[model samples]
Target chain A: MDNTESIYEKSVVPNTMGTKSFNIDNLFLVAFFGGVIPMVVLGAKNAKWLNISKKLIYMLIIFGAALLVTKLVFVAMITSGSLDLDNTTLNISYRVGSVLLFIAFKLVLNKAFHQHMVVCGKMEALLKPALIWIVVGIVVEFVLVVAVSM
Target chain B: MCEEQYANDRKMIEHYFSMDRYEDARPIIENLLLSDPQDPETLYLMGVVYLSREQYTEARELVQEALRNGYNPEYAFFFIGLTYQEQKMYAEAEDAYLRSLEINPNQANVNAAYGYLMLLTGHDEKAIKLLDEAIRIDPDDSAVNDYVYRFYLAKNDGSNQAQYLQRTMEIARNEQEKLINIAVYHLVKEDTKTAEEYLRQLYLLDPTNKHVLEVLEEINRTNHMLFLPNRLIDKIGGPAVFYIGFIILVLVLTWADINSIAIVILALYLITAGYTWLAPLLYRLFVKGKI
Candidate 1:
């Protein structure tokens, strides 16, 4: 018992109850509304206020490229007359492929971006938008599935 | 048994240890051991110091000796588990952890350590259950929050990862450690630029940290797009020729009533020739023998 007390006293335990906080840049919160247009508008409006790193831009590019490739491939197949399969199946395949690629891209980008946010002390600011984007992706997929079934 | 004198000695020993005055603590520990050679608590305390010193072999021997000397079995088992863990002996470590838990399941850091073991062994669900159990039992431990952060990071659960990392950063040991953690978090995600910012902060805090310097060097080495060949199209002069040929070929086929198969051959020839000639040159100039 005495040994335990001694050890406890010997350890400099950090105050785990420090006011839990994160950096909140309003410009970041506003930039995450929706759609490509809103994003461009946000960037244009907050060009000076925001600090967009090149790594994030690259992540966006890679993510966008994944979806873009699906379209490019679909267009190529149509132009080349390569599909003898059912049109519906091809359309479904393309759409599903695009959605899956987007999710894959989003997963990677989120991991990268969230880590960056954490390092920058913007962890709390990151979570809300990250959650929003994930929910939006899920809803979009669910709506697409429903539309297809109908 | 002079209980008050023992308590005073214990306080003095703790005072030295807390200040990281290991040199001062050692002589006192030696004196205590000489006086009461059978004291399990003294042996255990020495084992704890050895564990921190990373003398795993000596630590294991000392802790085992403490257990034999009738030390607190739970703590003895816990320290033994920790020694095994440091050595990456998962099976032995798990056995020790289970033994410790059997004695006292509520041992504060044990559940977290075992959860880490579970995670390493690919039982993520079990790991979470145990880790969550640890949190319920000891919510105030920043080390528990760190374990939670590692769990989220391993599972690629971004929101939780961010949340727990934030918690960790709040109570980190020092600016250097916090900066390193942040840098590592970003580095693992391959976000070198963001990682560099944290690493730069760490460098400012401790310029002698080789790990920070190495990561900075690695990021610099990998940012190869800075050296990519530019204006290759202008150098090749292929775009102008291709477009001019395209226009003439389109006019011939659509308006001049030329041989369709022959024009197709000519167009294909232009496309293939342009690629075959320029591709090797570009490859040699930009990509040959480079990682």
Candidate 2:
């Protein structure tokens, strides 16, 4: 066979050949249920699978710090009575904050995630790791909110 | 069975499959499976037979077995995904497609199938990306082009929708295919009058086609004044437009401090939602005699 024909005939590894990573939808679900920390952790794991862990981890740290600052300001506003303690407002703000964080994480990871999917068609389920991270994340969030509020 | 006989049977099975004659291939595949149950190729062929018969569970199991016995893992998983998709078990289908893609990311059809799954599951963003990738890899594939066309149609992206539709038409294998695509394009655009005209031409060309008749009936049903809500929703590009309008109306009312008016608007929104849902069911029941 000619070189071109030989190359064409050779079987390359399928896109599912690498370490399993979570898709964007799963990341969104993790973020929704577990909050930002778990979402970041899971995203970091996916980044690791895609061999871009350092980039994602660094971006996430910056995002986390920014989020902390925002939370502190939010709490300060509530304490100073600039913002009301209406449960609906508080709930909406928290959910919206989580969603925004999810969007930010998705923006950072989108290209890498697409590349990974294009290169390796299969992904691992995020459920087990998400459950663990969610518990830890919720606990941390609860503690942080209480501590900051005080 | 002797090696020569086995080889001949394999060729015959492949030929039958190419001819889309699964029934003709089944007995030979079954005999081969009986002779050597561990034979991965025979197992995979049997899976194909089961798939054609719509015995999805059986098809899936046989393909899994084939994969276990060292059949092509990527193709096997792709087949498994197809079985799941056919049964509308989308989650399972996604997993199988992922596995298949993991093994062979270059498979244009798998990418398109996965993209369509994403679309069905409301992941429009992901669907767009996958469908685009599928088209990039194999632009000539009419099905992939059709999917891209459908995705753009849903997004109400007129230019991209028209581009893909034209591409699909360009690749049409025959006049029948071109006519159907034109009819569908008009139907989705809610130009039912134009759609009906094309369907009539298609009907004249292929009189026994049940799909053409059903669509013609649908057009007839939607012409009634009672079906105006359905036609309006289709023209305005789906229920999402109404939802956005409703949200804006509520926001405006709240901003104006018109609480009573807001309540009335909410009632109106609910009534609109109910009518949109009910009108189609009513049409099916009254016009088609089925829901």
| The best candidate in terms of lDDT | 2
Count of backbone clashes, every candidate in sequence: 0, 12
Q: DockQ for each of the predicted structures, in order?
A: 0.03, 0.04
lDDT for each residue of candidate 1 in B136-213, tens digit (9 for 90 to 100): 888767667777877777566778878888888987756765776688679767687899898888788767567678
What TM-score against the true chain A does chain A of each candidate get? 0.31, 0.72
lDDT of each: 0.59, 0.74
Q: List the residue pairs that clash in candidate 1.
A: none
- Model 2 C-alpha lDDT per residue in residues B1-291, reported as the tens digit of each score: 888998899899989886457989999998988889999988999999988888999999998998999999889888998898776676778878888887778888888888876655545566777887888899998778877776666555679878988998998756777788788778766688998999999889878677789889868877977778756765774454455566678768888999899999999878876886587778778876887
- Tell me how large the interface RMSD of candidate 2 is: 12.5
Please give the C-alpha DockQ score of model 1: 0.03
| Model 1 segments more than 4 A misplaced | A1-150, B1-38, B171-177, B197-291
Chain B, candidate 2: TM-score: 0.62
Cα lDDT for residue A67, candidate 1: 50
Alpha carbon deviation, residue A55, candidate 1 (Å):
36
